[model samples]
Target: MKKIPVMAAALSAALLSVVMLTTFSGCAKKPKLYLYNWTYYTPDSVLRQFEKENNCEIIYDTFASNEELYAKLLSGGTGYDLVFPSGDYVSIMIKQNMLEKIDKSKLSNLVNIDPMVLQKATYDPKMEYSVPYYFGAAGIAVNTARVPQYEKSWSIFGRSDLQGKMTMLDDMREVLGDALVHLGYSVNTANPAEIAAARDLVNSAWKPNLIKFDAEAFGKGFADEDFWVVQGYAEVVYEEISEEQKKNTAFFIPPEGGPAYIDSMCLLKGAKNVDLAYKFIDFIHRPEIYAEFTDYFGFPATANIPARQLKKVTPYYQAEELTNVELKDDMGENLTLYDDAWLTIRVGD
Candidate 1:
């Protein structure tokens, strides 16, 4: 009787082990690709398709600005396989040795990128460590129904009549860049006098007519009609309003041009999902996939050349309008010039 019970227990234990092994192996977790990107940047549909096709999950995190992204990475944030940073910050990150070398041979779809965009990507023209994702600029979005007679110029912010109803971005580089370009200076100029001029212009001429410098709620303020004129990204302001409101909204890159940026996708130095990162980068440059991304944001196909034809909707602004726009460059230690100027501007009148 004792031997029979012992044998039964052994058989049960063997069956349990096999069952546990089968359950654990069958339910193995899928590989994950971690991304740190701009808020509301990648479209859900595209992410879904990529996840399904690759049988993997994407873990996405967002940062509002390049400074925030850089600060986070520099402070030892890890596990992010890829990041989207503007051209200036890409140069900064490259110098900081926080990025991995991208394998160009794996990115077969890179030929589809616009030659012009490549030429303008002075930060990483050869794309040794980064790939251009989008090239765009922040523009003025005016509510035509409320302010119909305004000129399409950066000077519109200086109008006393539009005071209290106007706002500019809190971003030092962008606001100061607008002022710099308005005065015919290079956006990347490190000349102290020129930077000072830009600073004084904002503090005197522009700040007086503005309600407040805002980056976060300008879109919502525009949609609510609280702000009739807002200097911001076209897609951000457009996404907040109705189709009917869009008819009355005028988004323009001022004639003199302002700061333009090419936000690129870069691989982090210690990323574990190296192969997946390359696959994702190539997948993004595919004409159809690229078109979907631009269409989602109502953005011009400025980077991916062939994707322009594949776009389903009209872009908010034309690629040609970016003609005079200059890419903001890494200032190295010279970034301190803008920092001091911005501090004074932000302290208010």
Candidate 2:
């Protein structure tokens, strides 16, 4: 009977040891920062370093467009610590009270941002609620290997010979913005007539040649030679192609100009990891880190001034090329005008 009692005590001690180890392991798990950003925007190396230094895990999610981001937030998709939205949607979110005010006092690296980028961020010039990430524009990418002759202009979309071999972004603002600039109008115009004119141009001219309005797979389509010409972000198109193909690729913002955008990192309201979010934001602005980001994507350091000197790779397009490009502004209620016209274009010819 005494031996049985002794064995029971030993078993009890073993159980307690296992319980203690499990609890310790659970407590040792790292904290996580949830980030919602655009697809293809974040670099793995930069993220891994941040995670290692902070001893925290990063949970990143991606959205394809500003509308998708807005819709998700509007639908009560909470728990995200940070998000990346373009300048136009930044203004919209501010107006709707969907964001948290940034505490600049916590960001020592804030000084690294380029002043020119801040000036263009009229939506939040003070950066009270947002931090500018990258400023860029969509441009036409043509395969010089296939298309031997072409103009570096938006007008190329109208060439019947290139019909069914081209594709434009399905985004209303971007597509309309292209036509508006080509027609010598502002990209953010709320004028009913101007919006209609842009809509008509896309429907009557560009649409005839386009294989389809594509936003997601145009990069792959371009890479596979399924489409000879595509209008999209330089990074997106370049990401899908190899070095040899990139040599034959010509990416440029049209001379007549089109809409440009400044995508920003913002803290979402009710974020649980406020301190970690701020840390990540400041980390991103650090010269070396920002340079790493731009280099990974072959992007110009449009927002981080110091990072420009640190970048190792050549950008797909130069910053000066955006001189003629116009920033897209929040239309507020006037957006309905463009929406109505876009409806006709999408549903019609």
Candidate 3:
């Protein structure tokens, strides 16, 4: 057979290449819905199940604290679809117009959330901007094996005997709030004199015993026997300890009160997949589904009422201890006072 002319063959080849390119390009995957939240907030099994059921990819990222999460959202160009911010940050975000107002009707599983938690989310009082995820109080994690003499109290931080073996959270609010609690002042107090007095108490009482202020890995130090007592959230105690290590650990919320927080799932203004975001909120609220998260993380589920009935969850929330706990309020312009105070403490100035 005679070969086709060179020009004819070249034209055919170019057309074939175009067809192949179009076919492949049309099938290219789109960007996945992005979730920015606290480290270890979403369990591995929970994430895998959600992705499998939705038949969609989820891009997950983490920040260690609410302040970090807030700053990231404030920087803009985040393109995040969802974020888990505590109540106070939710309030701040709403004021800045960085969050998308949620359509309550879309949340079919809304009834699953405990009405009490919803009522307490003051940042979204109308329940129009966010949905409660998990709420817990900030407290102390004591390694009883290394230091058995301590009581279930915040006074552990002021114990001179534990000096160089104790750690307080690096979070300014938690440290300052504890100081406020110790001084018999409200954690949300904005009075200059009140804040000054609390600051002085922290500097004298907690500074000497504190080997370091660590929120990220104080648990590891506890496990390693480096820290005899450490300050952290109630959930952190459960998250970082192994079964063996747990035998020697005791978690406590001081008698006076501790800083309580409600972490809510908020929609970002840049969420490209609003419908799916709502679906996710509804999906995670199911009792059994929510139990998987609580059981794995070892904290009580606040928003999911049925989850509270689960054997694994019932033990975590002692209402008498946690019910009247103080939730951190959005300080707005008053945040500067906290920043300055934290800076001074960190520098020993």
lDDT of all the models against the reference? Answer: 0.93, 0.91, 0.80
Per-residue lDDT of model 1, residues 81-129, tens digit only: 9999999999988988999998999999999989888899998899999
* TM-score: model 1 vs. ground truth: 0.93
Q: Model 2 segments beyond 4 Å from truth? A: 1-29
Q: How accurate is candidate 3 locally (lDDT)?
A: 0.80
Query: Candidate 2 on 1-349: residue-level lDDT in tens?
Result: 4455788989999999999999888757768999999887889998999999998999999987788989999998888999999998999889889899999999999899888888888889899999999999999999998898998899999999988899999888999999999999999998888988999999999999999999899999999999999999898899899989998999999988899999999999999999999999999999999999999998888888889899999999988888788899988899898888788878973
Per-residue lDDT over 1-349 for candidate 3, one digit per residue giving the tens place of the 0 to 100 score: 9899999999999999999999776546533678988898888898888888887778889988787887777776488888999899888888888889989889878788887776667667676888888877867778778787877667778889888999988888888988887788888888888888878888988898888898778877887888878787656666667879877877777778878889888999978988878878888897888888988766767678887777364433354566656888998789888888888899867
Question: In candidate 3, how many clashes are counted?
Answer: 0
TM-scores of the models, in the given order?
A: 0.93, 0.90, 0.86
Best model number under lDDT = 1
Give the root-mean-square deviation of each candidate in angstroms.
3.1, 3.1, 4.1
What TM-score quantifies how close candidate 3 is to the native fold?
A: 0.86
Question: lDDT score, residue 99, model 1?
Answer: 94
Q: List the residue pairs that clash in candidate 3.
A: none
Candidate 3, superposed: residue stretches over 4 Å from native: 1-31, 234-240, 311-320
